[model samples]
Target: MRIGSAASLDELFDLVLEAAHEAVGYESASLMTVDPAGDALTVRASRPGRLVGTRVPVGPSISWQTLERREPIIIEGPADKALGTTYTKDVPFSICLPMMVAAKTHGVLNVNRTAHPGSDVPLFLRILADQAAFAIERMELYGDLQHFTGQLLSQDEEHRRRLARDLHDGLAPILVSAHAQLQSAGVENEQVDKATALLRRAIRETREILGTVRPATLDDLGLVAAISAAAREMATESGWTLEEALDDPGPLSREAESTLYRVAVEALNNVKKHAAAHEVRLALLKNEDTLEIDVADDGHGFETEQWGEAGVRPGHFGLLGMRERVAFLGGLCKVQSKPGEGTTVRIVVPRDRLR
Candidate 1:
């Protein structure tokens, strides 16, 4: 609590990191902040002789997993292969917790010890982390309010512009031509058939546009139904096999449902636009604690190190948007890819956010 009351974030982090080491009695500790583009986490502070100011891709580490899942993780005994290879430490225990506020994770707090921390240690650290997270969130919320609003407005406008352009250039002409054909000397059977086909095509296009804007099925049926509907269409268009394994997801707040739906749409769009795979699988699972959405594709992947870096291809705005949307709901989004392997985008939002 004392650390959280600092006047500035730098002061707060310095005190918080110190508390993680001294008060928590960890041999080593570090603090990292998520990058603005949401592709990387940069070490902001660490114990002596450890890497500071180092930026790494968000994966294969407990800290990243905590950030990706927005939950606290404690590992005992030998670490899993993914966790063992992440950082060069001979420690026997580690604790990672997400610094979250209002569903958004601002950063991660990581601590390591040579042996298991006592029962009280975990509770103490958890309480400390929560307090610290709340403080940082309060600071960030006040600091970034204007900037966040501006970003939201800008993205919304861009989305509106795209929709307007599609309607004006694509759908309007079809509808107008159909109307003209109907008004012309269309007493002949051939003219009538042509007019009917044009009108049908126009109606389909209109529905497609509306679906993209806001799927009617989402409100009428629910998220699973809406996702299945969109995925089926994508599969037919791309000639890729789409598999689904959706458990009973139950109900969610409108914002949560819409955000998840948008993320699924973006993931599938990426598969269609970039992945040359023949198969894709999407799964939605509801467990006791959280809801997870996974989109996996068997397509050629790209190097994670090179992602969002300079000289990369330009069309990653979809990914940026997906991350932002998920983060807004206090969720974590992770994209994993390898060169000849495939890519998987997983989003995990806590069930507490559900209505």
Candidate 2:
């Protein structure tokens, strides 16, 4: 709140990133500015060496809730991603923090992650966002603002989902048929073994597609079972060791269950992407009344303090999305990381908050 007016735009952007990075341990950080046209936001600054100078349209974004309502909108997760979910029309997983100075809507500030930022980051984001809004609003430039990293991220995700689906629907069957043909053929020598290996590879690709498309089995079975399958799949694919400890999970509210699954999905994605450790530990437990999950890795941890302001890594929406999703559920998410020590994400939901 005490950031001086004399501070340069570069310095203010630094403060924004520092606030966001310090709030949550994101390997990447960004603060986007809405454009004057009320149509797009550009990533003016992002982590060092990151390609974040990207911009996207906000004319059709749901985060426009800030512009429409003139306030902030907090989102929980992708539970609302059902094909026809209203309010989520063409936009998913974006939380908007409005910027208003002198009673004019100069622009908006957007912060996001490729993976889910924990619920822990929002409060800090909300605060630092206000500071950044003031700084950005104060920047003495003409068409001064970049708007929607939310849109870019959402679109990218939509593409990933679509690509994953295409891989499943467009190519998975062909691979399956090939596997069947190889099995029924009379080739029983080294050729058969090679065919068998090819079939295994194809099946693995299909599983990867399914994982990307939001694991179907997750919806059929409960979160615990689905996440266990994901962990095992990760281990099998990467040869990394995984340790799982889950108790008997009772029937959670549909929303609660969904939140758990999505958060776990983000956590596992992080483990796969950043956690270089060969061994991972996942634990889900009901501590009498609270629902808690801990995903930890003995990998090279990230330095929370080094991230710059303006924009996060071009594609890193994990932490930002997670934070928004958990906040919607009234749950709490925390991340602790240390270089070489490891990184751990703890998500805790109070029983009373379950819906």
Top model by TM-score, which number?
A: 1
lDDT of each residue in 244-286, candidate 2, tens digit only: 9997677777767766787887888887888787888999988
Question: Over the stretch 194-283, how does candidate 1's per-residue lDDT look in tens digits?
Answer: 546646555444433433354446777789988888888998999999999998778787878878888898899898888888899999
- Candidate 1 whole-model C-alpha lDDT, 0 to 1: 0.75
- For model 1, the run of ten residues with the poorest summed lDDT: 308-317
Candidate 2, run of 10 with poorest lDDT: 142-151
Evaluate model 2: give its lDDT: 0.64
User: In angstroms, how far off is 4's CA in candidate 1?
Assistant: 37
User: What's the residue-level lDDT of 58 in candidate 2?
Assistant: 69
For each of the candidates, give the backbone clash count: 1, 35
**lDDT values, one for every candidate:** 0.75, 0.64
TM-scores of the candidates in the order shown: 0.41, 0.41
The local lDDT score (0 to 100) that residue 3 gets in candidate 2 is 50
